[model samples]
Target: MEIRARGARRPYRSYRTLIAAACAALLGVLLTPAGAQGAPRGPHGAVKVSQPVYSYADSVRESVWVDTGLDGDADGVSDRVVADIIRPAEPARQGRKIPVIMDASPYYSCCGRGNESQRKTYDADGTPLSFPLHYDNYFVPRGYAFVAVDLAGTSRSDGCADVGGPSDVRSAKAVVDWLNGRGRAYTTRTGTTRVQAGWTNGRTGMIGKSYDGTIANGVAATGVRGLETIVPISAISSWYDYYFQQGAPLQGSGPDWLANYVESPAARARCQVVQRRLVDEAPRTGDVTALWEARDYVKNAGRVTASVFAVHGTQDLNVRTKHLGQWWDALADAGVERKIWLSQTGHVDPFDFRRAEWVDALHRWFDHYLLGYDNGIERAPMADIERAPGQWSTDRVWPPRGTDTTTLRPAQGPVAGVGTLGRTAARPGTTATFTDDPRLDEEDWAETADLNTPDKSGFVTRPLSHDLRLSGSSTVTVTATPSTETAHLSAVLVDLGPDTIRDYNAPGEGITTLTERTCWGPSTPTDSSCYRETAPRTADVTHTVLSRGWADLGTYASASHGRPLTPGTRYTLTIDLAATDHVVPAGHRLALIVAGTDRGLIQPPSTTPTLTLDLARTSAHLPLVGGARAFTRATTGAAPTDPAAGRSRPDGVAEPRRTPPIPGESG
Candidate 1:
């Protein structure tokens, strides 16, 4: 939709003002008396106060090795993941327990974390000198202990990096078990000196971005105790969805590549066997094997007792929107208490895009869940969505309350090239044919909407008379006859109009880092809460592809099985596009592009194939905010003279970059 610039969007001065206000408000609440806010009692039945009376610089810093009970590297000894902890010393000295915030990550030593790529640092004696990101600096003095964990096989942890498998998940779960007194911990990796997490109140919260966040999701799904909540930003719900799409490989590399990338140098030789096992077990066929099931957190959502504060970029191509869509749906079905923030940026953290709001919301969420504070955060809106750049809105629940399915079918247009999209179905025998072209991708299909391309079929509706909002995932079902035994198909939903949008293709993926620094909390000589400021990067574009889906025709009947298609037989295939919440502005048309081999995004098929679609049975079922009536009211009008009507190629438009196996060094 054509959203007007919201008061000089993302101005530096405004950010400073907002952050100051939020911090002041938070400080005021924290300084309030314990019983004044009607806060709940702690596990020990003692009334707790949400105040930052402790000193950040004087926080205790130490490390402990938690036994994972797994021999991932076939070593004689059980694997013990390392946990580097920092907590207010006063709490322990006074025998006052505090809640814990843990971040279990494989990238702490290899790829680092956050916008600045801060890695964990240690003192000469092996005690942690600094924990990456601002979590420790910001929350440690605020009555919370922050733990930085080295996932098994990475950093100081012992074992093989199994990528997203049992080793990866259980290693982190072990730390939670130890904190709750269910597992054992040692002062040293090999020493017999037992250690206890006695300072903790046995309540914990996990938070992180990307892979770090992914581990939190996995651990929470294990039904582990003491993990009271999780804040997973741009995290994966399923490793299968991360590497593949509907039996179609999205990237050439598998779990083995990622495992090798994050394995510690000390364990390289020992981890080779585990790496080989990963490659052998994870077949490139994109089948749902036992290895994938072990990593599929969505299927195990029922086991999650931890309240989730999920954050994801709607346009995130790395850990695609499907991960969040499926996981969120599953969480809802399981009756899990959840909240989400959907940003317009790509593979980005809210800390970069909406820093002030993110920090404030997170503080409240943690206080409510982990610290037993009745701050009314659960009573707030369930969703905070950035509908447009720098413009946010909230809803009681995601996909909006009145959302319903609206099916739009393609019918033959008067001319030969493009088709008309409307409520009425095409005639029984109507058909559209297109041959597979490995060179063209979703970008090519979207840009050449007015042209008749040999590789794709375009269907467009009349310009909308009013804005039509689409709130959730969409399914594109096609009954097609293929000329080959196996082929690939891609469907993309596009907004055909001129508008200014976040430049997701930019260097920072929709954000430009500024030289100005903003500190969130108290800093030490070795570590600081200060970080470079950022503003949304914008681009004027003729069209924006809202959602895209790809699938293998060989697995048309089921995602797990692949059956050869008869040359002349008609088969129905369902391609589930990623979820989105977007509004097609008035005077803009909604278009659907059905194509083959979305290069770069999906692995190309072995052979090219021509497919003919039975237009009568082919339709796009979308979750429209107001359903069919809303769609009709918006689209029923004399077509406006589309600014892009005669353009054969769009300007300032680019396809979503295929995120590499390693999202980025700064992830």
Candidate 2:
């Protein structure tokens, strides 16, 4: 094995090969049986056996408080995180030490996990009476302990919630430490009665969605000893990326609001200073400061010892695709054993996308990593991507292989300064300019089809002669200068097809509410593992936004500091569009839109700033399926425009389309 120092970058071409090899070696070492003597279904195939080793109907439900050392609220006492666990009864009597499945989140007592918003329930004695979600009811029967922990300062825990800061991560890390017998836990916040994880085998796996999943990502990056695997669904690998894209602020007053929102009212009051700190620490300039650096898991990817199974929707505008895509790339560089599921839904769980398939895959994933089961999951394909809505395909790796890095430059004469995209670049002196219009929404930027607006510049490619698939993030490099010292730059990739597609940003995104309900597992009176079904909502399509990117022109040179550009003193800025999987069919035009601002996700600037682009050096590089040679050669004799092509809509605006809901997801 290669023994390079941590954080050293490996050759990009060889890292993927090393990841495969390293996973094989790590599997045998990490998956060794804890204790497997005289059992019928020994450690080899523990998960494959028919009968469950433990009983789900009768399990021990309890809570413990773990010490996190720091009192973030500045109280007199140290912080304590609350952990609610459901485990097999009398594990010591059976001489069995079960593995643990934990979900550490801040939403337990407030807005619960999953679509149903199910929260935890407690008895008069303050002990947990029931756990939320199907995790405990499903996994506990299969010999795994399910733990739901309320991060410090949230729910019933002590201390102030610092959002995704060090306190947040340290709180979760302490729970893993306690499970592995390296940390302390008590029956109550300040109780003398101590508790130990004698029922566990010291192997734990974390799983959750959104904030819960973000905890898993943060804790796993600490390289906690007992954490064997993690399943982060639409999780944030970096809080900075969650709030900012490139150097552009995605929203205003996010950090302070989020910090207070997740904490209890009493904790929020006590931590008012901390809330103020959050606001004070936030950089209004959108630069990556030390605060953001501390929350970034990408820099600490090398420390991740646990295997990862990541899930995210490419069209998720909330958490966004970059959160998972960038983190997935980092894990690859770290040579960790990892798998990914890329869907088309917006911020929805895989359970809602493909329930049966999701459960089966998740079951095998835990069995192999948490339990010592040799289920052949390691040899399976690394990625399961939704090519289109509801259409799934498996590949050896993400973005697939054999993609061509195609460069398409802006050519003039299509519509004044707004031009068409082609193989050749426009002459050096030619330029396109636009002023930032905070009033315009994404729909407005998209609907300006006739190039009648001076607020944005648009470029398009003639109807394609054949299908072209974009499988990864596209880079937009432009040579330009802002009219002011500070300005925001927005770039968008578009599909000018005359077909309707899923509108992920819409409410429910086409999912209709149904009266009927479906159950996932056997349930007790306290908890029902079931939900209602939903269907898709549909609309007509004219043009679709594929991927987008943003940047603050002042911070174009560095993220730590901004360098004001002297007006017309050109600076080259390369912005990375979000990663995506899109197919532009035959006779559909591909477009690149350059604008000064995007109001849909960002706050409006106080003043308008104009941007001038030197079209000669400007180009958009896309990772096309057929590569440049194959695509360019294939279209050598093909005409740019097709006679059978459909015309624009009556209002020149393509109506928003909603995606029909597919079966298998619960409402």
Candidate 3:
């Protein structure tokens, strides 16, 4: 094994050959238990497994092609399929046929394919965009053909890329057939025609992000034998739960815009111009259309045959953390031996050097499965990523699979105080109460959200005397009922007192800060201007919380499971603390704000789907181990000061304002 320090870049042409040679000498073909690898069928019915040919900065030509129909009698078919094949751009030292690696670009043409990313997405270095873009690039040089196809109707492909995974599976198969079929001579690299490898042992795999990552689930569902392993980054396990939780869209209009971009008419039209569209576009408005529903990998997640190394970001606003929950459940039930990692990184990490870390991991993954080289990846933690204060940790399984479950009940105390953890008194039935009229004011936004102060919550403050690491997405199941048919809920975790909250909020004023409360000073109890943010989140915030916009669930009246907290009656409200990793200085206390609204990120409730917290049926679930790591808030050993200036939201002089109730609510 070559030992190199961090950030060291060496030419791989020679190193790859060396690694291959070393691998060949040490391990021929490791023995495996029967059925564990399933029945193997190679190219043309014979199994032939050979070492992969890795590429180190080789000549690569980016071209587009039109795929003619292979089967004509299938009701309807796409005109042409577009593909992006990366072979050894120039001649290689080894004589090998193209071992094509085909990947599906799920929803490649969303919104409007017409104006895809501009500039052909070339980097400043003038090199065409490359893969290993997010994960590790170290492995690609090891003799693997990388093919990213734009399916039938998306991008440069021929037909359509429906929003569904089934269509995506078909799109993938089409490319797989093309690469190994008669077209082998068409895709040439250097001086030799490229052919599929792994046919020796039938080991082929795919790696991708977001929509692309989802194709692994679809392909696996088909029970296809050619697939070997998959690396699903920021993957969505179940579209239903991803887009909607508890029947209502957990996310708001944010993702709809993105989905439209993936399958929009404009992108479709552009495919016509470039002949890049893939599968035929599915008819919209049909409840039965595969795209409309059933995108959830969770439903059939148990059937996946491919070994998938699932990685996701704790702060991934696009796909969120729940994807991990659902996918893990499916894989576990199916008894699939898998590794899960939760990252603090953003979605799929397509751009920037931050993605470089994934390279180290990918090299290890491919080396183990594709080349049969064990590089110690199997012994790595199931969940691994940077932890609080820039440190990192790993667990055997997600949620550690063995961490003790603890209940954190909210009780009464000053929102800000030189306080204690949990609650002051630990009685069996502990509770905290605060009065929230239909009106209150929020002048600050939580940095926790991808949107400016996306979290919908309210807070009161006390001082924090010590720093704390508040990490991991949490669950708060409180029995709450609104006298009115509908209301919204916003829960926040804040650092209160002099230094903590001030220190945390000051970041909002960063040179030119965002969000309403910080941008615009806090307003009157009834003023909505202070609540609106320049960049709002996706959830509907209108009625219950004084959000920038409104989403009404309607007052369904009673929550069948819980009692209604009479407008004047004593009732319990629950708050889900946004995960954080900040240091609270000696003079500050972490403030946990439980409120009804914070525009953008979240808001109260509406009818048709009013919320009810069952006090009798309440609990809070926090995955304490190996999740999002809290930060070192007091690393500087100093307190934070107030913002020099604050920005406010646009105020309509004529709009009526609502006021939050003071601590007193009259019966």
Top candidate, metric lDDT: 1
List where candidate 2 sits over 4 angstroms from the true fold.
1-53, 414-418, 449-452, 633-667
Global lDDT scores for all candidate models: 0.80, 0.73, 0.39
Q: How accurate is candidate 3 locally (lDDT)?
A: 0.39
What lDDT would candidate 2 get against the real structure? 0.73
Q: TM-score of predicted model 3?
A: 0.57
In candidate 3, what are the lDDT values of residues 1-667, reduced to their tens digit? 0111122122111111000010011122322211112224345542233332333345353544534443211325434455554555323334444334445663433321100111122245423353322121222334555666664445544444444445556666555545444233223212233443222233557766666677766666555665667877666765544443322234443223333355436444543322221112222111122443556567676667777787765544445555665576667788765776543343423121122234335555665666665444565555554332123455445443323334443333343321223422224443333333333333344332112221222222233223333334455555454445444554444444322111111211111122222111111121111111111111212111111111122212222122223342333433334332232334544433444543333322442222333323344444432122221222223433432112111111112122111111010
Rank by TM-score (best first): 1, 2, 3
- Model 1 / residue 19 / CA error / Å: 22
The Cα error of candidate 2 at residue 64, in Å, is 0.6
Quantify how close model 2 is to the true structure by its C-alpha RMSD in Å. Answer: 10.3
Per-candidate TM vs. native? 0.89, 0.87, 0.57
TM-score of 2: 0.87
Worst 10 residues of 1 by lDDT: 1-10
| Worst 10-residue lDDT window, candidate 2 | 17-26
Error of 1 at 499 (Å): 1.2
